[model samples]
Target: MENIEHLYEEYAQTVYKYLFSLSQNADLSEELTQETFYQAMKTIHHFRGECKISVWLCQIAKHLWYNEINKKNKTRSISIDDLEIPVHTGKNVEAAVLQNEEKLALFRMLHRLDEKTKEVMYLRLSGDLSFSEIGDILGQSETWARVTFYRGKQKMMKGRSEWNSD
Candidate 1:
């Protein structure tokens, strides 16, 4: 019990941030974070200490996100207006505005991707998971994951160009 408590205390914020990045909804992210910990508590006995506790918690969060996504009855894309960009330190006001605009453009492009491509990209960028790890999570080969990422990037670039042109 103490160990589980310690694990939650140490990693809850990290797990919450991860879930928030994936879900893009504060309420839903909080719910999924709670669900992740609940599932972790139920399977605590099986933890072998081979991987970091945070990694294990992330796996739970990923599973919960996948379940929630699968259960969605409507197929819809995330809206650009819905993206939340984190503030970053900048050397100048111009740089800051440029950075924010770039981030918004990227988020808008990301929203145009299919769920699987977006999932892979998010796992790669936000989770810092390697192709093999992402493939394992998504049940695909590393090559397939790489291809999906490549295609996703191409699509994002095309979308950005079109947006800029307009």
Candidate 2:
């Protein structure tokens, strides 16, 4: 078994970003990330090594997010706007703003996708996970993950064109 600190050092940001993708609240995501690690620490023995450690960690994060929702008893739209976009130090502010706007529009389109596709998109784009990894994380086949992500991209493209036409 890996030490808790090593697991945390490696996967903390990924877990936090996954939570942020689900909740769209940075502070809440951060809190939940801490909670995730705490829970993982407590249940580490139960982990059967059936999937990647990152996948296991994310699964924990997802369950905590749902429990949080159940406790609140409210629904909210999923948005990825809170995820930080890297701004090059040399880039002009206007260029950065425009880039961010483009990303925001893409994220907005993602919001309109069905929940599963949106989660796949987030896992693919934000988490930088491969299709196979996403499949393992979501308990699906790699082909399914690939197809879902492809369909989601097509829908986003169509939405973007519609927005452009309007």
State the lDDT of candidate 2 residue by residue for 103-159, as single tens digits: 989889999999999989988887676787678678788999999999999999998
Per-residue C-alpha lDDT of model 1 across residues 1-166, encoded as one tens digit per residue: 7876887797777778778767778899889988888899999988897766776888889899998998773666688996987566656767888887988888788888999999889977776667876675565788998999999999998888888899
Error of 1 at 128 (Å): 1.5
Q: For candidate 1, what is the lDDT? A: 0.81
Quantify all predictions' global Cα lDDT against the true fold. Answer: 0.81, 0.87
Error of 1 at 94 (Å): 1.1
Off by over 4 Å in 2: 74-115, 123-147, 158-166
Top candidate on lDDT is 2
Root-mean-square deviation per candidate: 8.0, 6.8
